[model samples]
Target: MRVAYNEQMNALSKILGEMAGLAGSAMERATQSLLQADLSLAESVITEYDQIAALSHQAEERAFALLALQAPVAGDLRSVVSGIQIVADVDRMGALALHVAKIARRRHPNHALPEEVNGYFAEMGRIAVALGAAAQEVLISRDPERALRLREEDEAMDDLHRHLFTVLMDRNWSHGVAAAVDVTLLGRFYERFADHAVEVGRRVVFLVTGTLPSDEDHEIDLAHGR
Candidate 1:
């Protein structure tokens, strides 16, 4: 019974890793579409999001099955519970990517970003993709230290997000209010995508360490701009 339970747990972890990879890929393509105004790529990201959602559902079902039959305790129980939360984080990551693609499609035939601010978004997309990949690695490796490092990557994303607002708020800005609004929303999408990736890492840390990072620790991180 213990052998069977461990196999099921490992299978759940594999599914989560696959979901993370898909989420990362979705963001990559969405970024390309956003940068290049490629309607076809944007459309693909939008349509293929169902695949990620389906995987989330499958993972949730498996987790609940383990809980019901295995009666997992201690670390086993933590793994099952963490798997459920991780599923939500990964699903949200995919949804955030879908939003990025939708913005690209909405502006069809025209670039969503102004030329001056395009570099900011290009870097934001790169960081968001890297964070997603790191989240996947942590999930597979179950390394709490590696998972904790996601915070540093998330800080880089926060820095870019802050810098983007600075550009939008500049007195010399000439992109007009409509373009400003689009950029504002796009910046948020990337920031939130990175945030969710960080959340996945936190969940993995909890799964491995059996201790969730305290709210105070989280507050300290935020207070320090981590």
Candidate 2:
């Protein structure tokens, strides 16, 4: 049964890896849709989210069942429990990706955002991709320190996001209310994407330390304009 339990844990790891990959892809596709006004790609990512969620649910259930049946102790238990925590991160990441897709779909019919904002959107996509990649590395290596480093990279996205608002909120700027709303939502989507990335980093910390962080642990990254 020990061998069986070990095998189950390995399978869980594989599932989590796939989940992260899908989430990363979803975010990439969403960004392309937003940057290029590709409604079809946006719609596809949104529609595929159900599958992502389903896979996540399955991973959670398996992790729980392993706990209940195998009653893993010591390192085994830590591995199983940490795997569960990672699944939660993956699920949230998937949701963040789908959220971006929704914003893209809504902004369809309009041309892609102005050239000034495209680079920021691309930067956001880079962060989202990094977040998933970081999570996967943490899971595979159980390197909490590496995951913490990845968390710090989220600040880059936040800085870019702030710069975007600064450009849009200038007194002389006149993108109009509708365009402004779209831009605001796009910024929000990117910010939340980083937020989810931070959450994944927190999960990694939890997995390593076996302790969850408090709300006070978060450092606000909002721009001065807000």
Candidate 3:
């Protein structure tokens, strides 16, 4: 029974790792579609999102089954609970990527981002993808230190998000209101994507240490225009 329980727990980890990979790839492709105005790639990101959702469901089922069958106690119970929370974070990551893809699709035949701010979105995409990969590593390795390191990369994402607003609010800005709205929403999507990755790392820290970070040590303020 113990061996069976261990195997099931390992399987749950594997599913979560897969979900993280899919979510990260979706964001990467969605970024490409957004920058290049590639409808086909955007459509693919939209379509493939179902896979991440499916895996989230699968991971949840496995976690609940472990809880029911094993009645995991102490650290084992923490692992199961943290796995459930991580699933939610990863699912949100995928959903955020889907939003990005839809925006790209909606603005097809024309770039959603104005030429001046394209570099900002490009760098945002790079940071988001890197954070996702780091979160995945932390999940698989269950390393609290590596999990904590996600916050450092997330700081870069926040800087990019703030820079986006600086450009939009410039008095000399030439893009119309509609373009500003698109950039604002796109910046939020990437910023939220990075937030979810950080949340995943936080959950990993809980799974390993059985304690969450202090509120002060947690994610940056997500308030709009902050």
Q: Estimate, for each residue in 52-170, the C-alpha lDDT of model 1 and write its tens digit.
A: 99999999999999999999899989999999999999999999999999999999899989999889889999998999999999999999999988988788888878777878888
* lDDT for each candidate structure: 0.89, 0.77, 0.89
**Pairs of residues clashing in candidate 1:** none
Clashes of each: 0, 0, 0
User: After TM-score superposition, what is the CA distance of residue 218 in candidate 3 from its true location, in Å?
Assistant: 6.3
lDDT of 1 at 199: 86
lDDT for 203 in candidate 2 is 66
Query: How high is the lDDT of residue 58 in model 1?
Result: 96
- Could you tell me the TM-score of candidate 1? 0.94
TM-score for each candidate, following the candidate numbering: 0.94, 0.87, 0.96
Better of 1 and 2 by TM-score: 1
Task: Give the per-residue lDDT of model 2 (tens digit) for 23-71.
Answer: 8888889888888889999998999999889989899999999999899
Error of model 2, residue 89, in angstroms: 2.4
Candidate 1 least-lDDT 10 residues:
217-226
Find the 10 residues in a row with the least total lDDT in model 3: 217-226
Of 2 and 3, which scores higher on lDDT?
3
Cα lDDT of model 3 by residue, 1-226, tens digit: 6898889999999999888889889999999999999999999999999999999999999999999999999988999999999999999999999999999999999999999998998899998889888888888899999998898788898887777787888887898999999998898899889988998888899888989975443344445442
